[model samples]
Structures are given as structure tokens and as C-alpha cells.
Target chain A: MIELHNVSKVYNSGGAPVVALRNVNLTIAEGEFVALMGPSGSGKSTLLTIIGGMNSPTAGRVIVDGIDVYSLSPERQADFRYEYVGFVFQQLQLLPYLTALENVLLALAIAPTPRTEKIARAYEILAQVGLKGKEHRLPSQLSGGEQGRVAVARALVNRAPILLADEPTGNLDRATGMQVLELLRDLNGAGQTVVMVTHDPQAAACARRVVHILDGQIVGDTVPAPEHALAPAVLPISQPAIEPCSNATERVQ
Target chain B: MVLLVVGLAIGVATAVALMAITEAMQADVAVKMDEYGANILVVPKANDLALSYGGITVGSAAYDVATLSMPDVERIGTIKNAANISVVAPKLLGAVPLMGRPVLLAGVRFADELRLKRWWRVEQGMEPSEAADALAGARLAQSLAIQPGDEVEVNGRRFRVVGVLAENGSQDDDILFVDLSAAQLALDKPDAVSLVEVAALCTACPVEEMVEQISHVLPQARVTALRQAVTLRMETVGQLGRFAVAVSAVVIAIGALVVLTTMLGAVAERRQEIGLFRALGFRQRHVGRIILTEAALVSAAGGALGYLAGMGAAVTLAPRVANVTARVPWDPVLAAAAVGCALVVGVLASLYPAAQAARVDPTVALRSS
Candidate 1:
């Protein structure tokens, strides 16, 4: 569950005020998969960051899971992010030096879990994201879609309740993008909450609920019928099948 | 990392080599100074009185002269700093009539005298070993036209000249030396001594302290330290020590600057990586620890290698640079201190860079690709 009440963000760019968001009120129930759709500079990415607790609004408050997100100290806010939110940064921001498995493990680096258990959990998440055999490959060695899956695994590895993704399939081909979107739909079906930001209609169609924004304000919210949603793409015969992330919510938590 | 290590190594190496070479030179100069002559002189106490007529001061005369006895020379070794006394050469001086002219006669113990004045070289014949044998100074031998086998009569006593001393450009070239007992008998002043020349081994020996101790033992005698030689030796050693300290300070400062600049560059280059870590929920202290730990490791390695290289350089260069013959030995304590100081410097130098890294905004991760 997430709630934003009349949130607004302003950036001071060389003595001039630039408004990124204005009077935004939004809510999403638990386990909901929501997509934010907008044109470039429409403030969708900014809204995603604000909801993930990575950015503070210039005015108004953000409440997530019943607690005011910005009321805590900076250090405690980091703790809150660790406990409640996971971010899949745009462009699949995987550290180049680390392997796919290691990149996933970074999410749990500060966790209190035992080192062996953390490693096991990272491996399990990588497998569910269809990267079991490619765990040891560096990001440079993996395909664009595989790298995106590694980013998804990293976000889900810590079992945080909220997943905030920015352009998860932005760099993937049509078939590869369909696979990644289907993975998100499957994760949502199992009760994991996902909020993604995208400008692509085809990518946004994969979500159960779509919120359209323009000029820093939400203009439309809709639930596409199951039949109207983009159907899963037919895979080429040579393409590898991705493992379905069934029961991910229970396993991840 | 390699640059940091090399910078730290250079500083430590210069410090160690300077210390080793300075120590060797000090010891070398101390030994050479010890061989030069006696540093302390003990003489019979005397009072100077002006010899004047009614209103005109004609000259000065030494009154109440207390002659030092052989017992007083023996008691000079009883001081608290006696261990520093390398040689004690007692002498008796008097004027005796010889061949229609008055000549200065110095009675001395040849063994102790030779040890005290190491620079003395016998130009002809052997050292006088017999009670009836005597040595002549270069000028005295020239004036008397005496040979090594000639006989010299002094105070109606006949003595054989067994050796002729080389010209030393000192007052020693104008005196005749003989056995102390023989001169005591011929001068008819048995058990009398005029002065004592003490060669105190002054490597770490405190010359002033030895002088004070000797003065305490022979209260009736005037104990004087030849401060010219001691002060020169001390000043030379002190200058070397100060030079070492100054150079070490500069080298350490440059080394710290090297570390600081290199770490700052690393933080600047790793901005996106640091932002990523911050976004991953790593605390500020965690980021700082990562940078500091890297610095500590590199500096520790540099310190150890620097110590080895420094000692090797000292051993190879000391003889040519400082003219020292002693081999430089490895010092474990200095090694530990070098490594410890390098670690401390490295950590301190990296602090600002580490803080900069910790302050990196996590939002940069969202902005940067």
C-alpha cells in the first residue's frame, strides 16, 4: 500500500524554479502492479524515485505502508528503503566488475543474514529470473534482456515489499521485452507489488493498471481488461525459454 | 595504489638512510676525534699574582703553586665516570741545565703517553724503554745535533737518546722526554707531577660530566676540558641529526600530499560507483571504511619495502658518501615504526577523500548510466 497527498517537487536550476511535479495525489493497493505512462519530461521517473524514498518532495508528504516516509532521519530513511523498497534503475545499472550473481548479492550486502544464506538466496533469485545458468557471467557478457533480468533479480533478492522499476525493458528487443514484461506480470500474480515507469504503450499494456500523466499531473487511470492486454509474444524456435517466477511473493518474503 | 606505495616508500627510505648514514658518520668522527689528542687536562692549581713596583705593574707571577703528586694522578681514575677514561698519562716538567744551556725536561710514562697522544710518531730509533734511555723532540735534537745513539747530560746525570720524535708542529717539538722516576731522581723532586693528560673515550661519553667528576676527585688540581674538540664534534653530530629531521619532515609531507591527491582522484573517478553503493543502503561510514582500508593496505606494503630499500642503500652508500667504514645493521624497531607511521599517515591523508565519497548523492545512480 502506498499513498501520496498533494505532492509537489521543485528544482532550482541556476536561480530559476523548475517544477517537476505539481499537486499529485496517488494510491496503490497492496500487491498491485501499476504502470506510470507519460511523455519525456512528464515527471514519471521523478515520481517513481519519490515513491521509492530516494527523493524528497519539495512540498507535501509521502506515506508508505502506514508510516510517513520523510519524517525519519536520513539514516533511518535508508533503513526504511532497505526494509520496504527495491529499485531497478533505468538502463539496467549493474556494476560491471561484478558477475550477475554478485550484482544480485549486493542488495543483501548490509543485511543481517548469514553470508552463506545470502549467497543461497541470491542464487535462488537469479534462477527465478531465468539466469540460473548465467549466474557467473558479467553484465558485459550477458545479453540486454539477460542483464535486465539480473537487475530484476537484484531488486527482488532482498524481499522488499515494493519494487520500483524505471524502464525495465527500454533497451530490449520486441521478443526479449515481452519476456521481461511477462516476468513482471507473473511476479504481480503472486502478490509482489511492482510500480514501473515507461513511455512505451506496448510495455505499459503488460501492467494490470495504467496511470497516465501529463504536465506533472495524473490525467487518467485505467484497468485494461485481460483480453485487451498485450498477449505474450510467440518465441522463436531457437530462443531459450524463461523459467516462470511462480510463488515469488511467498519465496521472496 | 602503486603510486601511493611508491610515494610512501620514498619518504621512508630517505628517512632510514639519513638516520643510518648520520649515525655512522657521528661514530666515525668521534673515533677520529678520540685519536686526535686528550680531551681533558688536569694541571697543578696555581694563583696568578701581579708582580708590580709601587705604581707600575711590571709583570704577573704564579704564587701558591700546589704541585700535583703521583697520588693525585692515580686518584683521577677513581671518579664516577672512570669507565670513560681511556688513558691517563702523568707528566713532571722542570728546567735542567744541559751542555751550558737550560733545557725543558718532561718526564712521562711512555706507554700511557703513547696511548694518550695517538698521533705521535717516532722519526728515528725505537721508543725509550730503559730508565737511562730518553727521547728528544725534533727541534731539541736539531739544536743539540743529537743522534739516536748519542748521550745527553742533564742535571749532571748521563742519559742515552734512544729515539727522536717527528715534528708535530706543537710545543712537544721543543722538549726532551724521559722516564718519570728517572726525572724525579734527577730533578730531586720524587713523587711530584706537574700535569696529567686524560683521553676520555667520548663516543657517548659526556666530556663535561667527566671533567666535573675528575675535578671532584682531584679538588686541589684544575681539571679543564678541551672544549674546542668536544664542541666541534658535538656540533657536527648535531647538525647531521637536525638535517635528518628536516629532510624527513619534508619527505613525509610530500608523501602525505601524494596520498591525498591520489585518493581524491580515485573518489572523483568512482562517483557513479559510490552513488550506487549509497543507493544500495550502505551507510556513510561504510563507504569511508572502503577507501581507508585500501589506503592502509597500500601504505603498509610501501612501508615495509621502503625500510628494506633504505637500509640497503645506506649500506651501499655510507662508505662513499659519509666516508664511514661501519656496516649499517638492520633495525627491527625502526621497521615497525616506519610501517606504523605509514599506516597512520595513509589513513589520515585519505580522510577528506573518504568523506567526499560518503557524501555522494544516491540520486546520481538514477541520473548516471
Candidate 2:
């Protein structure tokens, strides 16, 4: 579970200070698929960044599981994020210089798995994301939908508990966006807690719960009916725990 | 990386070349100093008129005819630091008419003169074997159309020229060498010597004290130490070495500045990449290590290439610049030190830039487009 209490963020630029989030309080439980709805300049992304421990709130207490994440040192918070959270950005932040396989492997670079196990896990995640044969393609070579799949593969490579996605489908076409939304819903069905911020109501409709934000405060939180959601039959994304690579291919060639 | 390597290479090459040339020059200077013989000269105390205008000696030099006795020549050996004296050659100078031209003759002991003038080269035959045998100077031999085994009349006596001395662009090239006793007998000045040339180990001994001792024993003779000429030669060589070092230091500073500025720009350009690394769980020290590793690789390669280029420069340019025989001294310690200096410079130059890369805020860096 992730909890945010009295979260506030103030941008202290040269001119008048602008508050991005004000005294926001929210809680997300395990296996919950929550979509944050807000217009431009609302604090949905800021709240997500705070929840992910990627950014510090000017005033807040963020508790993940039983421990207050904000109370830990900055380095400890980064480690907490690395172990507990996987981020998928709206812009589809795949490193341009690295290939699709390498992009997914980055999450495993700091993982405790053996080098060969990391590669196998990375390959499994890419296969799960529907990018089996395109693993070696650079971002520029992949289509918009393919790149989006690569981003999802990177987030799922470590199998972290909570996935924080900001507008994951905002840049895709309608069909591709639906495909990505379906992927998220499948992952949510498999017991991964997901908190997403999206401007498209159709995108939000795929989630089980919706929270509306205006200005810097949450206005309403609601759980939509299952029939009213736009998602197709929610298929589960089952990724079995993989076995370690055999010693024959154990060394990283 | 290319820019960094190029900058470091320029600095390393300059430093290595300077050091190599300086060492070569110092070695050459040592050999030249050894060859610098006759640090003191003892001349007869006489009222002499050296009638010269500009640089050319006009008419004949007139002397009071005062000469040093054989006892005065032997007294130089008993000076205070007399063991420091290597050679004391007594010489007699006279002018003789030969083949309708006046030729100057120098009378010196063969062994003492050879020891005092290590640079002198004999082109033909050996030194005079008897009083009647003479060694003709190169220019005198050429002008008289004389060679070894040729006989020339000097002071109404036939003297055989046993050898021809190589030209040295000095007064020795215009004079003939003979035995002191022969000159004294031929000139009718028995038991008299003109002056003495002494080669002393001035660097290891107190030459000034030796001069004072010699003067105290023979107060009438002038004993000059030739300190000005020696000091001038050494000072010029030392100045060249200092100048090379100063120029090298300035070049190194410029190279470091180039590295600093280039690294700063690179850090600025890679702000988003650094932020991504931080977001991926890299510590600040890890980020710094990545940057420092890049610099180390570039600097190491640059140092190696620069060392080669520096040796090439020294071998190609040292002789032309300092007129010294030059070779790249093969010393592994020196090579390692040179490369180590380059590595230090590269690391130090990247310190602020690496820190800047590590200090980037993930929030700001990730937010930037």
C-alpha cells in the first residue's frame, strides 16, 4: 500500500511562487488500478512523482507498505524506488542510444540477479510486451506503438509491486492507445498496483477507480462499474518466476 | 574524447620534448666542459703595445722583451692545490721570415699541449720528433703549399714539417708548432720562455686560490683564471633549460583549460542522461566514477601517443636547436611518470565537471524536454 498525506509542492521560480499540489491526501492499496483524472496544469503528475519518491513534496508524509519513505535518506529513497516502483512515462522515455533489449535490461543492471538471469528476465519481459523479435531494434527504428510496448517492457522487467505511469497512452493513436490500456489492465489483473495520470476519459475508463483533480486538490474519487469500462475482457498477465540460466550459457558473452 | 586526448597530447609532447632536449644539452655541456682546457693563463709581465683597430691587429705587437725563466715555469707546480693542476705547458712565440712571408711559430711540449687541447685534430703525420721537425698549421700549410715530409727554412735553418694541424678558425690555424728549445735556440734567446698554459680542474678545486698562490710566487707574472668565459657558457646553457621548462608549463596550463571547458560543456549537454542514471538508482559517486573513467582512458592514450611524439621531436629537433647530439633516454620510470602526470591533470581538470554531473537534480533534469 502507498499513502500520501498533506502533500504540497511549490515551484519557487524567479517570479511569484506557484503551488503544484496543495495538502493532497490519497491512498492506494495492493492490486488496485487507480487512474488520476485532471486537466493541464493540475497536480496529478506531481502527486504521482511524490508517490513514486522521484520528487520530494514541500510538505508530506509518504508511507509505502509500513515505512515512511520520505523519512528515509535520499539515497535510501532511491533504493526504495528502485526495488518497489517501476515508472512508465507519458513521453515513452526509452533511451535513444540503446537498443530495445538493452532498454529493458537497464532495470536489471542494479538488480541482484546473476548476469545471465538478468538477460533471460529481460528477454521474458520483452516477450511479454509483444516485442519478441524486435528486441535489438533502436527506438528510432520502432513504431510509436512498438516504442510504447518497449517502455512497458522496461517498467515490467523488474516486476516491482507498484507501477507509476503518467499519460502512458497520451502520445499513441487511438487503436495503439487502447492496446496499451489493455496491457495495463492485464497487469493490474495480475495483482500489480497501478496509479496512472491521464487526460483522456476513455483512457481512464479502463481503470476500476478514478480520482478527479482540479487546481492542486483532489475533487472526487469514484469506482466505476465494470460494465461501463471501455476495456475488453481483462486478461491476466501471468509472468511465471523464471529459472536461472544453465551454466552452459551462464557467462555474459 | 578526441578533444580531450588532443589537448593532453599537446601538453605531454611539449613537456617530454623539453625534458629530453634539456637532458641532452646537459650531457653535451658536460662533454664540452671537459674539453674546455687551459682554465688559467700565465703571461710574462711586460709593457706591450697591442696596436689594433676594430678587431684586426694592425701592425706588429711590440714587447719590452721581458721573458719568464725556467724556474718561473716550474714554480706553477708548487701552488696550493697544485695536485689539481693537470697540465702546465710552457710556450715560446716568435716570428720568422719563410718563403718571403712572415710566419708565427709556437714552441710547446707535445704531451702538455695535447692534454690541454683535446679538441685539436692532426690531419697528417705525428708531432715533431726532433728540434728540426715542425707541425705546420692547416692555413699555413695550404698557403705555403706544404705537406707532411716537406722541408721549410725558418730562422736560417731547414725544418721538416712532420704534420699539418686541422683548421680551428683561430690564431692556431695561422701558426706553426715546434719545440720550445728549438724556438729558443733558433731565435737566439736561450733559457727563456714566453708564457705558460695551465689546465686545472677548476670545478673541483679552488682555482682562485691557485691563481693567488701562483701570483704570490711570481708576482711579476699575470695569472688570470678565465672565470668569465666559463661562467658565461654554463649560464647560457642553464638559461636554455629554464626557458624550455617555463614554456612547457604554460602549454600544460592551456591544455588543462581546454579539458576543463570541454568537460563542462559535455556535462551540460548530458544533463538528462545523468538524471536518467540517477533515477535508475546510480549513486552520485557512481556517476562521478563513470566520468572519471572516461577521462582516464582518454588521457592514458593521449599520454602514450604524446610520449612517442615527444621523443620524435627531440631526436629530430634537438641537434638543430642546441647543437647537441640528442637521443631519447630509455627510462621506464620517466615514461611512467610522464603518463602519470597526464592522468593527474585529466582527473583534476574533470573534478568540477564531474561534480556538476553528479549534482544534477533528477526532478529538474527529467522535467526538461
Candidate 3:
């Protein structure tokens, strides 16, 4: 379980303090697929980074698996990040120089595992993500959707319980984005807790629950109907795309 | 990396070459100074008498009443510092009537004189080795119109000229040289020597101390030390050593500056890569180790190549510049020291740049694409 208590983040912009997150409190349980929906500059990505222990909240305590993430020393915090969380950065941030297999192996670079075992685990993860035959290809050689799968494989290779993804499909077309959304849904279905930030309602519908934020404040929390949930087949012609929320006062309940 | 290696190699090469050249030059100068002749002069003690007329002194006359003889010159060899003596040539001087004119005559042992005056060249025939043989100076032979193998009468004794010496720009160019016993007999002063020239090996031994030792053994003679010659040789060698050290220091500083500037630029370009490593849970020390290892490898290569190039250049240049016959040998101690110095410089120069790489923020991964 992941819990955030009154987490607030402030940035100094040319000597003036700007607040990115304001008194945000949330909780995510094991095996949950949660989507954070917000427009640009809405602090949705900030919340995800804070949860992953990559960003320090101005005032708050983040507890993951009964351990306070911020209370550890910097070195211990790095170890905690390695053992507990895996991050899929925005735009799928695959290192261009590394091959698909090598990119996946980066997650275990500091792991105490032997070299042979690390290679075997990296190979297994790449094959699981549908990149078995293209493990030696560079990112430039792979398609946009294939690169997204590489990022997902890098995150899942560590086998951490919590996966934090920020705008995973922001750079892909609708059809390719749907493929990545399906991959995330499958990973979450395999008992992995996922916290993803996105603005598209179609992407949000793939998650079981959605949290909406505007201006650094959470406005609503909702669970969609069963018919609105993503299915393996193409979307039905009768079910139209849901509109994005406009204000903090709007709620699905 | 290539630029760093080349810069460091050039610095090491210059230092090594300068040191080799300086040593060769000092050795060459010592040889030349040794050939210039004796640094100590021994002469008979003078007796002075004042000549006056009607209370007005015409002049003062000085003569050697007690002349230095063969026994006094032999006693000079038994001194405490006798081992430092390299050559001792005794000469008997007199004036003899020859061809209706009084000519200066100097009698010396040819073997001892030849060894002390290594720069002398015989222009015609060979040196005088027999008691009745004589060697004529360039000016004296020309003025008398004497040729080699010609018989000349000195003090009613006939002697054959066997050789004529080349012009040496010294007092030897105007005198006739003969065997010491023959000159002593012709001048009616047997076993008398006017002066002695002593060549002392002074590289490690002091000339003044040797002069004092010789004086104690030959009390009837005056011993003098040539201070100007010794001072000149020492000062020349000292100046060359100081010059080599100064140039080497400047080159090493330039090499270090090149490494620091190039490494700083490399660190700036690799910021995103370093951030990725940090995000992968690598410690700051690991990042620093990577950078330092690269510098050390490059410096080691530079040091080895520099040593070879420097030694080759020293062997070729020493002969032409320093005028030394002996070639400079490859020194193993110098080779090791060169490589060690280069490694130390490279690591110290890269320290700041490595620290900057270690300080890269891991949050850069989230910000940059």
C-alpha cells in the first residue's frame, strides 16, 4: 500500500514561490490500477514523482509498505527506490544508445545479482513484452509503440511492487497508445499496483479507478460503469468517448 | 583522449632531452678545460737587489739566486696529494749565442710536456726524442730559416732540428726546445730547472689544497693556484643545470592545464548520461572512478611514448650540440619516474571534473527527453 498525507510541493521561480501540489492526500492499495487525470501544469506528474520518491514534498510524509520513504537517508532512499518502485519516465525516455535488451538490463545494474542471472532476467522480461526477436535493435530502429513496450519492460524487469508511469503514451497516436494501455492493464491484472498520470479519458477508462485534479488539488474520485471498462475487442460504436472534466466542482458520483 | 596523450608526451620529452643535453655539455666542457693546460705553476723564489746612483734608484733587479733543481721537482711528487697530480713538466731556461744573436733556449722532457699540452700539433717531422735532437717553435724557425733535419750550433754544441711546432699563440712559439740535460750542459748549469708546470686533476680535488701541499715539499719554489680557470668551469656547469630545471617545470604545468580544461568539457557534455547512471542507483564514488580510470590509461600511454622519443632525440642531438663523442644511454630510472609523474598529474587534474559528474542530479532524467 502507498499513502500520501497532506503532500505539498513548492518551487522557486525567479525568487517567487510557486506551489505545484496543495495539501494532496491519497492512498493506493495493492493490485490497484489508478489513473490521475489532469491537464498541463495541473501537478499530476509531480504527484507521481513524489510517490516514486524521486521528488521531495515540501510538507508531508509518504509511507510505502509501512516504511516512511522520506525518513530514510539519501543512500537508503536510493536503495528503497530500487527495491520498491520502478519509474517509466515521460515520453518513454528510452536511452537511445542502448539496445532494447540493454535498456531493460539497466534496472538491475546495481542489483547484487550475478551477471549471468541479470542477463537471463533481462531476456525474459524483453520476451514477455513482445520484443524477443528485436532485443538487439536500438530505439531509433523500433517503432513508437515498440519503444513504449521497451520502457514498460525496463520498469517491470526489477519486479518492484509499485510502478509509476508519467504520460506513458503522450507521444504516440491513438491506435499505438491503446496498445500500451493494454500492456499496462495486463501488468496491473498480474497483481502489480500501478499509478499512471494521463489526460485522455480513453486512457483513463482502462484503469479501474480515476482521480481528477485541477490546479494542484484533487477534485473528484470515481469508478466507471462496467460497460465503460476496456475490452480486448475494438470499441463499440454505441459507447462514445467521455468528455474531460472542466472544473474542481465536477464529480462522477 | 588523443589530445591529452600528445600534450603530456610532449612535456615529458622536453624535460628528458634537456637533462641529457645538460649532462653531456658539462662532460664536454671538462674535457676542453683539461686540454687548456696546467692550473698550478711552480717557479724559483726571487732574490731582489736595489741598484742606486747618487741616492736616485735606477731600478730594482730580481734574480733567482737559489734555482729549483731536479731534486726539488722530484720532491714535489712525494706530497700527500700526489695522486691528484696528473702531469709535471720541468723546464730549464737560458740564453745562448746562435748565428751571432742571443736566442732563448728552453729544455724539457718531451713525454711529460706532450701529455700536459694535448692541444699542440707538430707541423713538420716528429718530436725530439734524442739528447742531440731539438724542436723549433714556429716563429723561431721562420726567423732563423731553419728546416727539419738541419744542424744548428748552440753554445758551440751542434744539435739537429727534428721538428717544428705549429703557431700556438703562446710563449712556446718563440723559443727553441731541447732535451733538459742537453740544455743544462749547454748553459753550464747542470741539473737546474727554472720552472715547473703541474696539471692537477681538479674535478673533485681542490687546486688550492694541492698547491699548498706542493709548496711544503718544494720550499725553494713558489706555488700558485689558477683560481680563474676553476671558477669558470664550475659556474658554467651550474648555470646549465638550473636552466634545465626551470624549463621542465613550465612544461609540466602546461600539461596539467590541458588535462583539466579538456576533462571539464567532457563532463559538461555527459550530464544526461551521468543522471541516468545515478537514477540506476550507482553511488557517487562509482561515477568518479569511471572518469579517473580513463585519465590514468591515457596518461600511461603518453608517458611510455615520450620516454622513447626523448631518448632518441637526446642521442642524436647531444653529439652535434654538446660536441661529445660518447652517446647518451637509455636510463631505466628516468623512464619509470616519467611515467609515475604523468599518472599523478592526470589524476590530480581530473579530480574537479569527476566531482562535478558525481554531483549530477538524478531528477534530470524526468526533465530531459
Candidate 4:
């Protein structure tokens, strides 16, 4: 569980300070699928960043898993993020020199896992993200959708419970975005707490609860269908094949 | 290790070649002056004309043999510094042809002068005691390709070589030693000499003034001291050393440039790698150490190789050639110092690159695609 009590985040570029999060307060309990829905400037990304411990709130306190996440030192914040949160960025930031599996394995360098056991864990995670046989390939050799899948594998490589995705499909087409969305939805359904921020409603629909914001304030919190979602999409093809019902409104998420 | 070796090769060869050539020139000139270590020489003024301008006219005349009678030799021997002096007033020198090469023939009162000028070391046979025979320096025998039993035609006279002096590469190595009467009669000049040398105490003061004043006192004669030649040789050697140092400096500059370029590019290429390391919990100093280590490795190799190659050049290539001697000066120290300095310089060169690598923002860096 994570909470931000009336948090406000501001940044100073040269002289003037710019406010990103303003008097915002929110909470998500354990194993919850929360989607932050807002316009481009609605501070949704700011809220997610604050909750992720990437940026500290200017005013309010942040509590996560029964600990004052911000009260911990900056170094401790990084350690906590590394241990507790998995991040899937708008751009799939895979290192160029590393293979797909090694990109995931990079997180293991800081893990308490034995060196001999890390490769097995990396391959397992890669398999879990529908990247079973593609571990040896470089990011450049993979498709956009596949690269995003690898990034997901990397984020979860350390087995971090709280997954934070900032526009998971911002770089993908509708078909690929659906595949990725279904993947995240499956992880949320499997008792994984996931906070995804997106401007697209369909993506937000995959979440059990959607928190909508306008400007920098939370305007509405809505409940959607099937509050419990799919389970971390185990390589999709394993599920029984279904007909392609293209109603176009099955909700892209 | 590879870089250190290459760099050492470059550095040692550069420093050694420079050092050996200069030392060789110095040694060559010094040995000659030492052989002429009679300390002082008094020659008749008119014979001085023949000595200075002797090569131009083969039979030019000035000083009469009658002027340098044994009485004058005795009179000059009475100086306070002359107590140990055995005057070496050889007959006039003349060129003889042997195997088509010119060789200077010397006629000396070797039996007496051997006491005053005893520097010559006999390497072969024995000194010429019988008349109509001669002693030759080892180099002179090599030039004529002659042995002790060999006979050489000199000024239309045949003279046999009874002995040869060891090689010192001095003026003594280029001339033949014979009896004064035999030399004077062979060249048809009687009781005269090209020059005279007087050995005296190696004491301090007035060597220049004594030679000048003493020669001034002697009628129609010129006196030259050995110190003047030594001074000239010493000054020449000093200049040559400075020239060697200048050349060594150029080599060091080139080495520095090579190292700088290599390290700079390596730093740039490794920037992302550095950031990767920093995010993995490595401190800035750790990043700095890696870079410095690379540089030290490169420079140490260069230094070691340079020293070995330099000494090799000196020892192998120097003596066999002209004006070069194998003088490996402080080789071990220079090699170690160059390598150590290369390490320090490598650390310094890494400073800027390390700083840049350290300043990389993990947040912004993770932002890139």
C-alpha cells in the first residue's frame, strides 16, 4: 500500500519555481490496480513519480508498505525503489550493448541473489514476460513490442512488488499496446500492486479503479468492470485461443 | 603491460642514442688529449710555422735542425717543473704510403721519453730497439693492414714494424714510432722536430701563463699547454650533452601526445560504462581509479621499452660506427623514473575525463532510449 497526503512537488530551473503536484492526496491499498487518468498537464505523471520515490513531494508525507518512504534518506529511497518498485518507462530504456536477458540481469547485480543463480532468475523472468526464447537477442534485434516486453522483464527481474508504468504503450501501436496492457493487467490480477498513468481511457480501463484528475487535483475516482484483472500474462499463447471479435469497443485495454 | 612495454622501448631508445653519441665524442677527444698528456710543449717559432702549415708543402723549410741542439734541450730541461721531464724532441714527421693509405712516421728518443710519457701500452711484440725498425699504434697497423713482421715503405725507405701500441683512438694510434736519427735521415731533415713536449707536475695555477711566459722567454719558439686542449674537449662534450638533452625532450613530448590522445578517447568511449558503474553504487573515486590505472599501465610500458631500446642502441650500434660510444648512463634509474612518471602523468590526464564521467546524472542517463 502507498499514500500521498496532500503532496505538492515543485522544481526550480533557473529562478522561478514550477509546481508539478499541488495539494494532491491519494492512496492505493495492497494488491490494487490503480490507473491515474488525466490530461497531459493534469499532474498524473507527477503523482506517479512522487509515489515511485523518483522525486520527493515538496510538502506532504509519503508512506509505502508501512514505512515513511520520503523520511528515509535519499540513498535509502533509491535502495527502496530498487527493492520495492518496478518501473516501465514511456521509452523502453534498454542498454544498447546488453542482450535482452542481460538487460534484465543488470538489476540482479545489486540483488542479494547468488551470482550463479542470477542467470536462471533472469531467464525465468524473461519467460514470464512472453520473451522465453528471445533472451539472447539484443534490443536492436527485437520489435518495438518485444523491446517493451523486455523492459517489463527487467523491471520485474528483482521481483519488486509495486509496478509503476508511465504510459506503457506510449510507443506501441494498438495491437502491441493491447498485448502489453494485458500483460500488466495479468500482473495486477496476480496480487501485484500496479499504478499505471496514462492519458488513454482504454488503458485506464484495464485497472479495477481509475483515479481521474483535472489540472493538478483529483476530480473523480471511478470503478470499472471486472475489478480483478488478468494474471501477469504468461506468454499469452498458453491461454486457450479465442475468436477475433473486432467490435472495436472491446476496450483496447 | 603491452602499452608499458611499447612506451618503454620508445623512451629508452630515444634517451640512450642521444646519450651514447655525445659520450663517445667526448671519450674519443679526451683519450687523445690524455695520450698527449705531456702537459706542455715548446716548439721553435719557425718550426711552429712548419707545424701549422705543414700539410700544404711536403718539403717546406723554416727552423734549422742546428737550432735545436742537445744543449738547448738540456737548457730547457733545467726549469723547476722539469726535474722529472724527459724531453721528447722527435725528428720532423713525414707521410708514407702503405696499402694506398697515408700514415704519419714518427722518430722519437723513445728510450728516454718513455720515462716522462709512459702512457703507451704495448699490445703486441716489443718496442723498436734496433735501428731501421719502428713501433706502430694498433690502429695504424690496422689502417695499413700490417703485422709486427711486416715491412712498410716510408719516404722511399723500408722500415719493419717491431711492435704495435694498443688501440686508444688517439693521435698516437695514427703514427709510427722510430729512432730520431732514422726518421731525420729517411726524410732528409737533420736534428730538427715538428714539435717538442715537456711533462711537468699536474699542480695547480699558471699553466696557461707559464706556457705563455716561458715560450715568450724562449727565442723564436712557441709553448702550448695540455690543459687548453682538455678544456676545449670538455666544453665540446658539454655542448654535445645539451644537444642530446634537447633531442630527448622532443621524444618525451611525442610520447605524451600519444598517451594523451589514447586516454582521452578511452575516457570518452567509457562514459556510459562509467555511468553504469556509478549507478551500481561505485563512488566517483572508484571511477577515477580505473581510468588512472589504464594510463599508468600505458606509460609504464612505454618507459621500460624506451630504456632497453636506448641501451641496446648504445651498446650494439654505437661503438662500431663513427663518433659514437656505448655509454649507458643511469639506465635503470631512467627506466624506472620514466615509467613512474608515466603513471603520474596518466593519473593527471585522467582527471578531467574522470570528472566528466563522475558528473553524469543517473536520472537523466536512464531517461535516454
- Top candidate on TM-score is 1
- Minimal lDDT window, size 10, model 1 chain B: B52-61
Please write out the lDDT profile of model 4 over residues A1-253, one tens digit for every residue.
7978889878786999877778887888888777888889788887877787766788998889888888986567667777787878776667888999898887676667788799999998888888888999999999887888888887787788788888888889876777777778767767888899888876776776778777788877766433222112112112222222122332312
Which candidate gets the maximum lDDT versus the true structure? 1
Clashes of each: 0, 0, 0, 24
Most DockQ-accurate candidate: 1
Q: Write the candidate numbers in order of decreasing DockQ.
A: 1, 3, 2, 4
Model 1 in CAPRI terms: which quality? Answer: acceptable
Clashing pairs in 2: none
How well does candidate 4 match the true structure in TM-score terms? 0.56
Residues B1-369 of candidate 1: C-alpha lDDT, one tens digit per residue: 778889899888888888878877777777777776788888766664342211212212257677788989889889888988888988877778877777878889998888777788999988988899999999989998988999988887889999999998887887889999899888888998877888988767899999999888888877888878578777978998899989987888888999999999999988888877777777788789889999999889988888888888888999998888766757787789888878898899999999999888777778745
**Tens digit per residue, CA lDDT, model 1, A96-117:** 9999999999889889999999
Candidate 4 regions with alpha-carbon error over 4 angstroms: A225-253, B1-158, B161-361, B365-369
Candidate 4 local lDDT, B212-318, one digit each (tens): 55565566566667676567767877887898888877766666666666666676666555554444334456556767766666666665666667667777766
TM-score-better candidate, 2 vs 4: 2
Q: How well does candidate 3 score on lDDT at residue A115?
A: 91
For model 4, report DockQ. 0.08
Ten consecutive residues with minimal summed lDDT in candidate 1 chain A? A233-242
Interface RMSD of 4: 4.2
* Top-down lDDT ranking: 1, 3, 2, 4
Scored by Cα lDDT, where does model 2 land? 0.78
Docking class of 2: acceptable
Residue B107 alpha-carbon offset, candidate 3, angstroms:
4.9
